[model samples]
Target chain A: MAKVPVQFTLNGSEKAEFIDSGTTLLHALRDKIGDTSPKGGCHQGTCGACSVIVDGELRLSCLTLAETCNGATITTTSGLAEGGVLHPLQRAFLDTFATQCGFCTPGMIMAAKVLLDHTPNPSREDVVEALSGNICRCTGYEPIIQAVLTAARGNSQNAA
Target chain B: MAIRRGRGVAAINYPTGMNLGGDPTQALVHSTPTGNFMVTLSSVDLGQGMKQIMAQICAETIGVPTDCVVVDTADTDTGPHCMGTFASRGTHRAGNAVIQAAKEARQVMLEVAAEELEVNASDLETDGQGNILVKGAPQKSISIFDVALSAHFKRGRSISGRGMFLIPRSYPEKETGAMKPSTCYAHACTVAEVEVDDETGEVTVLTVKNVFEIGRALNPKMVEQQLVGGSWMGISHALYETTEPYYPNRDHGGTDFNQYLMPGPGDLAETEIIVLERPSADGPYGAKGPGEMCANPQIPAVANAVFDAVGVRVDTLPITPERILRALKAQAN
Candidate 1:
């Protein structure tokens, strides 16, 4: 194993870290940056638990080699809420009870965010299509779909 | 291009809690100087909202608001004994224990409030909103917080209570092997509508409608989430997952989920759930548990639907397209 220096912006902060060559971005974020919000569900990229926004694109952090993302920006679930105010998707997820176990939540939320960014007000079918990559064992897909649909309707989040 | 649709229904019942004596869970409730109460348990949440459910029980029992009760679980060293969180026992078993503990603690609270107000302990009643008021005089009241301070400092009595709930064992009858298994049983029924392609043998689930009689839904939102998650799991088990003859024939089989099929978001169907409340006589707040029963009915419902659609009975798990085609061919022959 060889350690390599990689530089990138994590949650809007500049960071440079040394990691082994075979390290996945999920490990880099969790092991190096100490951000455990991005989960390591299935390292083969099938389970979207390790979802991260890389340069404004939702990518599975487990499949992406840390060294390959040397100069890119990364956003994990930790960065979704700004200044203690949760994003609409995050709020909707809580309100709709979209999260259960929360292991796959960050990825699911990231996946839904990309869809809303592309289509501000997507139909139910569109929400389903965007969530194809993410898998949630709890709350089924209906709650997540409803949460995303609610967020798309310009409804403000009310966290309880 | 010939797609045929059919509907099928299934009903199932499951017992709550483990069926053995000494399957006990202990709860410890102690009041804080800030007038809030903390409950400690050894049962794990496993993301099932056990902590929240326990908090709700404690709040109601102690006559405090739901927010004033905090639950801390899964510290094996510090927390008391718990039989774990499975068997849908978090609500029925552990919840019963919490109710007992909070009730004991509330007795002391009323006593202290009585002494401070110069009234009989029986005359003081909790408003269930963090206040102790005299019966028939709602306007005359003192906050539970101030009374907690008096109990801790002036009266010098510890405001803490411990509780444990255990089920008794019943001897089975010699002839029938029948005995009490659980304190209560939860029932569910599901109807699944699916479409099958006559040519390709591909099956598409369209909708799932369900009704559950879970005694009483302790937390209605959490109950709904459980049902929704369970329905998909049933779909995955019935139609997508498989581990079969390929293992001995091939050295390496589908090792991960990519090779082992599971349903994704694209495969999700419309879901409608109806919850019926039938209060349990013994359960805390007339509530029973609804954990594993969530996924039981979905499996057979889909299988029955496929049979209804193609007039072929494929009695196998993961009712794959290959199996459906094979069954269709056999029926044609």
Candidate 2:
């Protein structure tokens, strides 16, 4: 396969890479940058597990060709945490047992973060609308919804 | 000498927003032969956290940290083959086993303590730390480890325990000729309200409520989480999934998560879980199976919700708007 040069900012860092047309942004993020937080669930963009924010809009990385990134900043789930401590959303998820298999967590959290960033104090309906793209097989949305609400309430986290 | 056997039972709870239709029953027992205690289960975790619930049951029954009680998974190699793990039978069945095993271990400890301390078995009490205390004297004590060590070294004996349980069967009112003691039932009711686009037939689940009657809750948080996830799976099955038909002409196709349309976050209604606790006679800590029971109602609930919104009842699953629109057009003609 022929190769193409691509440049994109990952998690607020500058990066330049060369990849073939068939190489997806997900592949570059996972294989090249070695960030495994954004999972590859449905490479066809149906399963939103590979969703990422491109220039502040939620986009499916699997569907986007690597060459199209070209100097765009890509933020993944790894960037959600600070210095080994979990993000508030991650902590809330654990406390409320929102995450079960954890396969959809990174994307779910990313999508939720985008919503929260835009609407800091979103209503329950807003949270639902924001997370509609992610999928979790365990912890029905009840616990997850509660966790997001709890995080918004300033509850202490890191409890097992 | 604590062989308490009781009839298993089931109860139902319907949430304000949702209606449910299913039955699940579970039982558990704990026993001790010598002093070695083991926790066993017929429930499969499937990464759903059943193992943790089993450990918690042991810890609560025997009074130890959940981590202290080791879990043994489904093994036909072990004695007493269970019905297998699909119906949330772990805490109910395995929990009872842990209780029986822990009680047996406790008996051995009491006997040894009574002999060494020159006190009657009735006069001894187990401290929360699995230690034996001589009632009035707080300082004169022995840990479970000490008792286990004594039984192994000084007494030249070993302690062991076992447990067994089974759920009562349901559907057919009374078991007549071929009835084996299948006496456990867990009930749930789920409701969903939805909005469907008349043009595209894209049905959006607006809200969902699940109300269940579990005999007991080992961990309420975990139970609620699993139920929610399960509801989503059911909703996915009802509205978005397509299965390849075995018949020559039908359209049955797809492989794995890629081709299949499982319910993403977008497909789910804002879910609410209402847990109703009504302890069963046979379950451990009054705990019953609640895992698979919730999934059953979610499908029908979504289907009904779509009907409420668009006045079109979807008999078949994966009720896409395309199908709904087609149904509407067919009705118009």
Candidate 3:
């Protein structure tokens, strides 16, 4: 297979990589750009472990073509932190013990970030719906929901 | 199309560690030059918080803060021997090994502190706050950091220890096929409530309440994680999951997550867990294994709940809508 060139902004940094013609964004990001935070739980896009934000919309990177994402601004779990400060979702995950095996944490956090960005004061049901796409075998989904709720409450308090 | 509600309960006693040719695990503990402890083992964590719990056990045994201890595992070349991480043996077997290793390393740490304080090793006591103080006088004390510095630069002694734990093998009688399978046992009981739709033959688990008697909760949060997640797995196995829809025919097995059904977060039922600690005599810090047992009783409990709901028995796993419908049809006939 012939290799193709693709360029995109990843986690605020401009990264250009050469990939196979049919390479997925997940493969491009992990293998080509070396940003391995996006885990590939299922290449079939069933498990949301490869979730990433492309142009402000959540897309399963494993199912997305890298060439289609040209000039797109991508956000991942690695981009959530700034200047050595953890994102509210990240901090809440640690504080609430939302992670265990942690393979699903990146995608779960990314999904929660999208939810909080749109609905800053989400309810417990909202958190559950947002994270339902991601599969976490270790946490039983309760702690992750609690962490999302905690993050939303923290964000609301900060605004107040 | 009416929904019938019913409840069922189950109790189980799960073995902690298998007695297969003397289940054994080894650990190596050594103090760094800065007085921090490193525990080395080949045991894998498997997301069960093995590393974190091992660090806690090592810190407690060495009388040091947990933050000062680091657990490095699963490097067979550098790490010590382990009998794998299955059969719920990581906490019971590897934990005891880590405790033994930490004790020996703690002995050397105290000896070094004793030399600096000009007191006998027997008279020295660790304050659990990085200080080694005399038994009678707390004023005369040496920091573990200073003790490590002296042991490394001045005393020229290496503070290290190796430990291994082995369970005695119990052989089965040839005719009777009976033996002591494990050293310690963890018990649990689960009460599962479900609503069954007679028309659709769909079972919706309403709630799962359970009590576990795990010898001790080394880390309550980790134990809770296992129990909660394990119960979810049990629910999945009871209703949604099946690799072979038609067993003995390898034609249509699920190849991925899409085909293999699992209960999503939205499908989760209300779960309540109560942990009971009955400390074991031989366990490390009286901790037994709660890894695999947390998923056991819920399988039967769910199966029984389905039987109670519609008064029809579905003997096979993953009490699917089809199975329930078939059983109801057979009952009607």
Candidate 4:
């Protein structure tokens, strides 16, 4: 096996690392960059726990190859906040009590961020469709759906 | 393609705390000189918010704000003896232990404050802001920080308290095989509504309405999570999930999430919950366990709902489309 050189911008910082060609981007982020926020659940790319933003698109890190991530701008749940101020999704999740066990929080938040980035104000069905890939065993989807809607409302209020 | 809707109800009970034989949990509480209180518990949080509930209980008992109490649920090497966090025993078992320990520490704190203020400990009351004041004279007060410092340096007192709670074993009845297995029992009643397709034998759970006598919620949000999560688990077990699809062959169940067939966001049903506060006599702050009880009742409720929807009883796990179709065919024939 040959070691491949990969360079990517993570959480707004440029990082370079050499890894085996077989390593998934999930392994590179968690093992190499030391950002454990993106949880590894269901490595089959079904459960969205390992979700991340690659070049402004949601991609499952568990499925994305490390070699394929070179020169890509990556964002994770760890980068959602700036200087300890929680992101809108994080605040909404807390306020609506959307997260329980918190194992799926990072991925759920990432998915919500992507939805809000595109839709801005999504309907309940839209939120459901957007988060259909993510699995949260604890909240039963009610609170998470409500949290995303609330975050969208907040975004609209802030814009007003 | 007609969809028939029907509803059914079931009620169930769950015991709080493990009381097989002297199931004991201990707590260690000590007041730091900086007016902060530290409570050591061996119970794991497990994302159930046990740490938050215990911290709130400790603060309430000590007459201080919740933020002033630090619940250090350290591992077994550092923390006190807890039988781990399971069986819905964290709030009922560890909570009582924390209450006892906090009260003892509060007594010593009041005593030190009494001596410093030249007043009897009985005459002083905690303002819940770390201040001990004379009952009538608001101006006469002493901070807990001063008392804690005095207790540590001058009075030769450590301001620490220890507490342990155990449920003595109740022998099983010889004939009935019945015994008191826990300190308290929590109850829940659930009604599940379902829509059944007679042609395809598909059952979709529409809504779940529930009433829970949970003693005290402790934290209402946490309790609601258990209820909602348990409802989903119950629905999954009834319609969507199974391990022994081929019985008597314990080779392997469904391997991954796709094969396991758990309920996703699209399947989430509407829920209406009514929480009844019937405090338990023995539980701390009259709080009982509602963690596992939520999942138990919905199993029977969904089964009954399926029967009501199609007038056939399929007494199997993950009531599949095939089973429903077979039952309907048998009934029609």
Give the top-scoring candidate (TM-score). Answer: 3
Candidate 1 residue lDDT tens string, A1-160: 6789999999899999999998999899999989998899879889898999999899999999999999998888899899999998999999999988988788888988888878887888899888888887776788899899999886333322
lDDT by residue (B1-333, candidate 1, tens digit) is 489998999999888887666478899999998689999999899888898899999998898999999899859788899888888888888889999999889898888888998889899888888899999987878998899899988998777889999887777899999988877888899999999998998989999898988887889999888888988888888888767624346744567878877787778888888999999888889888888888889889999999999888888777888889999999889
User: By lDDT, who's the top model here?
Assistant: 3
Q: What ranking of all candidate models by lDDT puts the best one first? A: 3, 4, 1, 2
lDDT of 3 by residue, B298-329 (tens): 88998899889999988888899999999999
Interface RMSD of each: 1.0, 2.8, 1.1, 1.1
Model 1 misses residue A151 by how many Å? 1.4
Q: Where does model 3 exceed 4 Å of error?
A: B174-176
| Clash statistics: count for each candidate | 0, 48, 0, 0
Alpha carbon RMSD to native, model 3: 1.4
Report the Cα lDDT for candidate 1.
Answer: 0.87
Give the C-alpha miss distance for residue B232 in model 1, angstroms: 1.9
Task: Provide the TM-score of chain A alone for each candidate, in the order shown.
Answer: 0.93, 0.89, 0.97, 0.98
- Give the winner by DockQ: 4
Off by over 4 Å in 1: A155-160, B242-254, B329-333
Tens-place lDDT per residue, model 2, A1-160, is 7778888888877888777777899998899878898899878776678888888888888998888878787888888788899888888888878777778878888887787667767788888888777767666566677677777665323322
Q: Is candidate 1 or candidate 4 better by TM-score?
A: 4
Point out where model 4 deviates above 4 Å. Answer: B175-178
Native-to-model Cα distance after best TM-score fit, residue B221 in candidate 2, in Å: 2.0
| Candidate 4 CAPRI classification by DockQ | medium
Q: Which candidate model has the greater TM-score, 1 or 2?
A: 1
Give per-residue CA lDDT, model 4, range A66-87, as digits (tens): 8998999999999989999999
